[model samples]
Target: MRIRIRTKWNNQEREVSLEDTVSVLAFNSWRIGMQSLLEIENENFQTDTQMQRIAVLEEMMAFLVHLLDRIAYSSLNDSDREALVSAFAVKLADHVHDNARDFAKGDHRNNFINKLNIRLVDYSETTWANIAQEPGFSMGLTFGNHIADALGPRDKKWVLDYIQQVLMPEMVKLFKQVLARLGLINNEN
Candidate 1:
């Protein structure tokens, strides 16, 4: 069987197809894996824990994508769409932080790096590249500035510091709330 996914990119609706044998869990796992790897390398974030979190977040992200795809294929209201997006962002953040303590010590593999590169190329061919690179490509300038900032400190200390201190905690909190609401995590009395 085939399923259609509708995503709005560049103010247009795009459709993606999924196979029947793919479980929601498997689809999500693959998408999240690809996404997390891309973010880590593109952003130049380090820390084994952060990388691991990225991998896990990839799965969660995939799950959200699956859900969104289903909704888009069907008839979903505006409120529903908004809520799903919000929930997805939150869950994504949490999945990124679930194993922080351990992540700090581990590093990503070469396989992950290669896969991420391929995925990025594929993604760039899609509308996302247009969305990300906008306002006269001002975003590219911002990214360059970030790289420059990292180059300033000895051993790129500033960059590493930001990943650990700023990005990680924020991501964790967002995902935690999302997971709670989705009933992926229990809120016991």
Candidate 2:
């Protein structure tokens, strides 16, 4: 079987077998449909991962709030407060440190450096003051030391202040950057 194809330029006629003609259309349609499906699946996977990350962040936030309330209203002693702050700091620091790569996102020009720079400063200022003098702090050890210093030997108010002022806000920003990098959220900057 065959069909004719006419060119508008010269009305030149050509013979095309029916199978060949239909094959191109059919293959293209199937390819396009598959591409669309793959795109949707990819989008859904990203959404699911982002949603899970958000849920974990919210849970951590809730834990902080609850801890703050306990510190505020309870009759826990100074040591207890310090311990609470230390525990939370270690956890928070670990979480942030683990996901740092996702937010740091290499040296790309579009990297989240603006927001990430502040967090890095906070991490540095909060953790290591004279790293040169020490010259021995690994990333994990530095985080541990920094978290300890950041929350050390303080009263309940200090604990509350550190969490409310420093920790939570940084976590929020870091996660926001992560989501933005993932294109899960729109970034104005």
Largest lDDT belongs to which candidate? 1
By summed lDDT, the worst window of 10 consecutive residues in model 2 runs over: 1-10
| Candidate of highest TM-score | 1
lDDT of 2 by residue, 1-189 (tens): 011222122233655433333333223222332333233234332223433342233234323323232322233466754554344334443343345446444432222223233334434433221322111124223333333332323332333444344444444344333323333235533
RMSD of candidates 1 onward, in order? 15.9, 25.8
lDDT of 1 by residue, 1-189 (tens): 112222223433344222211232233433444443455456665424444445434433433343333333234466755555444433434434344335554333333334334433433333212221111223223222333342343435555444344433333334333333333344322
The residue pairs in collision within model 1 are 32-58, 48-103, 48-106, 49-103, 49-104, 90-175, 94-175
- TM-score per candidate: 0.29, 0.24
lDDT of 1: 0.37
Worst ten in a row by lDDT for model 1: 127-136
